[model samples]
Target chain A: MSDSTPSTPRGSADPFVPAELYTQVQQFYARQMGLLDDGFPDAWADTFTEDAVFQEASRLDEPLRGRDAIRDSSRARKKRLEAEEIDFRHWLGMLDVRPQADGSLHARSYALAMRTRRGGELDIFASVVCHDRLVSVEGAWQVAERDLHHDGSGRD
Target chain B: MSDSTPSTPRGSADPFVPAELYTQVQQFYARQMGLLDDGFPDAWADTFTEDAVFQEASRLDEPLRGRDAIRDSSRARKKRLEAEEIDFRHWLGMLDVRPQADGSLHARSYALAMRTRRGGELDIFASVVCHDRLVSVEGAWQVAERDLHHDGSGRD
Candidate 1:
């Protein structure tokens, strides 16, 4: 399922992607989101590479760099959402995956964050496009860089 | 590269996506956007399958179903944008692609709509996630269904 072999450049004549590799990448994202929505920020943070870069929509002034910073932000976000009694679900869909020459995968997807308040009033809190650069580390897919572009000026 | 061969069911042990096929799929969406941004609404609408379904953010109550409706709406949108002298660019990224058992592909990506007014002052107008279902016909990939979920209650 994992391709450890050296990859050709983006324009190479042969750019085959195995079905298993695609599925594995998809599953990796699913797990990351599941952990975040299910109140496991630490686990979700672990999905990123050690030197991961995350650019969130709300915080444009400072990008979260490295795994420790990402984990801290995730933890803070989880606490804030919980304290506000907001039940949030992050739905990721419409993914396009492209394998790069450096044995990494460049993936993009749409993200919809829906929130339910105390009275069960559900609303879409955030909509953004997530651009990710992913790398395979020890047979696992980890996010190396993620740039989130928000649809509007609002919190996700 | 286009693969006319029959696709195996999802979760199959063998799911092979040729490099050329992947490139073709990416190009299809790119062409679609190019046409729209270049003020060719009719051509952009033609990128969809005959019976395509499109659910936009502003008109949630009315989902554009079929090619005719899609074309009409696109034309109208283009006219409105042009009349207002709005320079809009739809940036799509983070695409995740999955092959379905029914020989179709499910793709999702993030979209950010940026607008510049007559004064050249740019702003992020809308952020949304686009979920798409695509199929290949005559060696060309066409969008079968698209659902745009906006981040907030704002126009994109």
Candidate 2:
């Protein structure tokens, strides 16, 4: 909330972005993941651009192209988890943010999917490295591409 | 490493600190926790002020006082974990940063300790919310006090 305006000049392309931009990117992920965990699949998908591509290299044969495709997959996953009485919290950390030459941002982070079953135990559902291409749309950050690399899958 | 310089004027503590200060606080925790996880207990302890106090409300009857005490405890724990061939990775997220009237920073974050046994399984060792009072010492951030609230303990 501390002034999300782009303070850096266009085409700066710094190895690391400004601290304000870094904090903003973290907040953006927090909101996006919170939306997904709260069962708002459409809202979560809306954080992505219309033609965003999401790929899990370890499992997916091809990327899920487009926001609609992402939304459908998220909804189906949420429904299955709900039926199984499982709750998931996606935690992100160790973020690396850098400015791109085209006024976009490159973000990479470690993603942990912590799963808990109602009246049951808590466990790790997935551990992956997320690489994202972020662009601004209407002054809000949106994911244009996301590639996930699962741990120990030799995908990297 | 965007300038760690305090840009905000003194005695102007808002509900939240500036975004640059927020990101710097995150970086501080990243380095502090990384040192502990990387088997540098003494180095990790050095991140705290000499008179720092650390307390776990749910478990510790009395808080650990002084950097020496913290270092001793951390070294002992590290030895035990190494003997058992266990590796831990501390992941922190959802950080809340606010400025204090005393020019210090109040930072709170969700900390996840993920444990992995050599050639064995990976699991969550602990989940806690860490509340810290961070002070700048010689232009470097250090923990002055830390209070940990473990999940399901209801100490909060």
Candidate 3:
């Protein structure tokens, strides 16, 4: 109905490749990944949806929600992360995005993330599950609900 | 096309549902979830194609080819994990599984996992993408190629 993509893909006005969605999502993450690795924690939070709820380590908090909250939270996170040392590299793959009945999307991506602090890079494997509400806002699809799946083997 | 759902689902033989294949594949996983949780890792891996590839981690390895390798690796992993002093929960969600062009079913699942170790649970989320090759072997459907994605956040 929203012309996001076809129910059956293959034939549609929208570019309907699940892999491509990951590529677009990757672009959205560039801002945060760079900042997080550099200790600019707050800046990394800027990439979240205004009403975004970040679920991490069993502590689900609206660290930033609504347009106003996002701006303020970004600034705070950036300042806090400047002190902690971290080198995080994320290898996101095996991306799958499907169109839902309500015109929204349910996407799942595989991650092989490695974090380095002093010397060695410890591999951390995780599955990031997201339920995204996509809308044609200003001709681009932005995030809606990023329901993360903190499910997986910690060892990579 | 084949139906891979168990008889319990709403429309098991809708013609549009692909019943035979659906029942076989669906039941197999219906069995997998329980067995894997019950600690029969190798037996669980036996449901895959001989050239099966299961990459628990996103890496240069791409896909973990061969059923024997997948079985051995899964067994080894279970051995290591069962010995850890950690609270580990493996959750696999079924999103949708489609019968592919080659009759193989490509399934996408949303995964949310948490591991509590040393008084803290680092919430690691991942999106598991499975491309399964289903076959009517001895009256059942088995998996073939599974490409699990383990890194990056696929937000809206």
Candidate 4:
């Protein structure tokens, strides 16, 4: 559902924003998330801005800062999941995208992390609200900041 | 992942489509699926054309034809889920939308159905690929036909 209101002042006067931009953002997340889930931390990290900040308030004492930090953490997580023989799939939906005045886009989406065991058992690992600040870099959208509010974490 | 190739001509000459139309289609699915998941079968069914056809080849001997039939099946499924005290959320991603020559849209997406029990236990209920033909009715998009191919069903 749309989280933005008239007070938010979208880039367009029309009720809806451009479909191409929205599609690009969606495809960006799909590729980025797919990379991370597929154990390609370097590729996934490349989708973020050099100075990206990722915050998971309930899990980490401090937000992960910069591409290096994000990549490191992602690599560690991939290794751990591999050792555990588990697979993860991140599904994002209910996106609410708003274009900012400075050319960046403020997007929020419902993120669901599903885990599947080697034995074919699957479960929802986490349900979270993802807030992202996305900017265009070389004609592609990259995440500058991502804040995750996990369900029932009481941090949202 | 875009399912369509260069052989599939989109409405525009540009590689990407109008963001407004893509956003509208996404919003339409969000609302339609949300209504069904929230137990509003009537509203969910209304999102389909009066003569809509839904095919779940693996599950049924024949396709569900017409809005009335779709509503009845949805209501029945809602009752069964209620009895089982389970919540099902349908998530769609990796959308590839192509504007057809008839002004309709041929859209394909990965669909995931997650089930959550009363005690907060959750699992991936099903993974499927969904193909849809959408038409605009009264300035809003409605499902004219939907074909679902379950993962590993050997039907795709």
Candidate 5:
């Protein structure tokens, strides 16, 4: 650990947020992605809080609320992919994590979800920006709310 | 700064990399994105090293080598976008930054590029996975090499 504070050329007011926390959040998301891609939807759902909210851009009118709803939707999606024999990979990048005054975190990142049909070529199925509000639960950061903002959506 | 090192659930060997360093790298990339989006092609080009290698998945046949080449390419791109009157925005997310043995950094993230044609609706132009090799030059992180992997490129 270096004692030096991070240099913020853009003059960020909150320059004192611990870097380790950011790393932890990055790792948390990585684990979530891994679980989702590796066919472990149940495990992935466990990463969220009991009262977490997950919203998809296309279905903003009906956001999934609570862990059960999130898990059910994930399982249904996974089942559909399996039934269709589609191989999907979700890749995430450009994570911007900020500390909130409430001791939680406001995190955002870009996501690319690609799918490949059996013996068919791969195609980008979705490109969206994920905005998340994460809270620490039992010394671990759990996503409390996630909102997906679809890029190129004129509404956004 | 907390003396306690972050607990690594996945057994990351380099858990001790300073959070400040990670924050600096994130900020560096954010600044680069801001410059490009704000139409500062020259300043954006300055984010790369003199001997940097920039490769795009769609243009692997002609990788841009050196700062001059990078700047020229960026300027040309800006000109083309302007000539066509296309409004473009690139968003990056889910950054995974790791330390290299040589004190550089190996980073990966997802990128979403959107473009809106004149009198047309916005659409996703490109979705890519960015693999970057970054180095700290003069206490600031610079892109030493960037290899973009387009997700869902059947070739991948």
Candidate 6:
């Protein structure tokens, strides 16, 4: 998400979207693609708050917390897919955003990600939904938080 | 990635990080974990700009554009995953945000995801990156655009 400063009511009326802001968001997400796809553990660490309460818990598993811990997890996961250097391609569509009373906003986006390995017959895909928060920082808009949703539920 | 606004500064006087901005970022990323684990897509759409761009590209590839198109991509992906009623879990972590000129931001994050099938060693883990933009909408922050990086290039 584009991380930037908040505008006063006196600014753009009707809560219209600005091209500049969209550009910023594009850039931010682009960088994230780099960190995740490039297998850069340290890069992911720069995405959240220092004391961020990062936990990815499943319905049947415990949660993973903290930036450093998350980095380790990312490294491990990347290593597994590193064989033949499989590439994960995400196709996100169907998004809707709404404003909140507390000046916070919420958004839901639908995504389809495909992972294709080099010279392989496997090209796996998954469906996902994303939830996130945006907060103004240092005069820019940035992703204050983010979460991912995998569609449909059934036991393994 | 969160595309909503939380209160923070444009730049921090401190060398690396600032206190308020740090906490806001933490809250933002943590907020996402809760939303996705719960699988709430309806609320997720409200986080974006009305005229937003959603893309899926390599950090090095040309970006796909627009919210409506992104939606189509999402639907296609969801159908594919829901097959056989598998339960998928998205592991989101390793967030990094960088301030930019024009009051925007670029960020990097990592995800380790898996699915539980009817019977098997579950599914493969996923590694993904995202690009997002932020803008001031109605005096608050909201996502202007979002891009998906799945090529595993990490070329930001």
Residue B92 error, candidate 2, Å? 3.3
C-alpha lDDT of all candidate models, in order: 0.73, 0.80, 0.50, 0.79, 0.75, 0.51
Let me know the TM-score candidate 5 reaches against the reference structure: 0.60
lDDT per residue for candidate 5 within B1-156, as digits (tens), equals: 011322222433234346676567668778898888777899998999999999886656888899999898889888998999888887776666778889899887667778888999977755566889998899878899999865444343
Which candidate tops TM-score? 5
**Which lDDT tens digits does candidate 4 get at residues B106-125?**
98899888776655555767
RMSD value for candidate 1? 11.7
Instruction: Write the residue-wise lDDT of candidate 6 on A1-156 in tens digits.
Output: 111212121112224233344334445555765677777767766664444444322331544555666667778878888865887655443333445566544544555667777876655455556665655556644445556645443321
What 10-residue stretch in candidate 1 chain B is worst by lDDT? B1-10
Model 6 Cα shift for residue B51 (angstroms): 25
Lowest lDDT 10-residue stretch of candidate 4 chain A:
A1-10
TM-score of chain B of each: 0.81, 0.87, 0.66, 0.89, 0.84, 0.60
Task: Please provide, for model 4 over A34-147, each residue's C-alpha lDDT reduced to its tens digit, 9 standing for 90 to 100.
Answer: 999999999999989999999998679999999999999999999999999999999888776777789998887778988898998877777666889999999888999999
Q: How would you encode candidate 2's per-residue C-alpha lDDT over B61-110 as one tens digit per residue? A: 99999999999998888878777776667788888887778989888899
Comparison by lDDT, 1 against 5, better one? 5
Candidate 1 per-residue C-alpha lDDT over B61-100 given as tens digits, one digit per residue, 9 for 90 to 100: 8888999998998899899988989888886654556688
Tens-digit per-residue lDDT, A57-141, candidate 2 = 8679989999999999999989999999989999888786767789998887778878899999988756666889999999999
Query: Docking category for candidate 1?
Result: incorrect
Winning model by DockQ: 4
Minimal lDDT window, size 10, model 4 chain B = B8-17
Ranking by TM-score: 5, 4, 2, 1, 3, 6
What lDDT would candidate 3 get against the real structure? 0.50
List model 3 lDDT by residue over B77-126, tens digit each: 55665566343444555546666567566665655454544334455544
On the 0 to 100 scale, the lDDT of residue A116 in model 6 is: 74
Write down the TM-score of every candidate: 0.57, 0.58, 0.43, 0.58, 0.60, 0.42
Residues A87-148, model 5: lDDT tens digits: 57677767778887898888888987777665555577778999999998877678999999
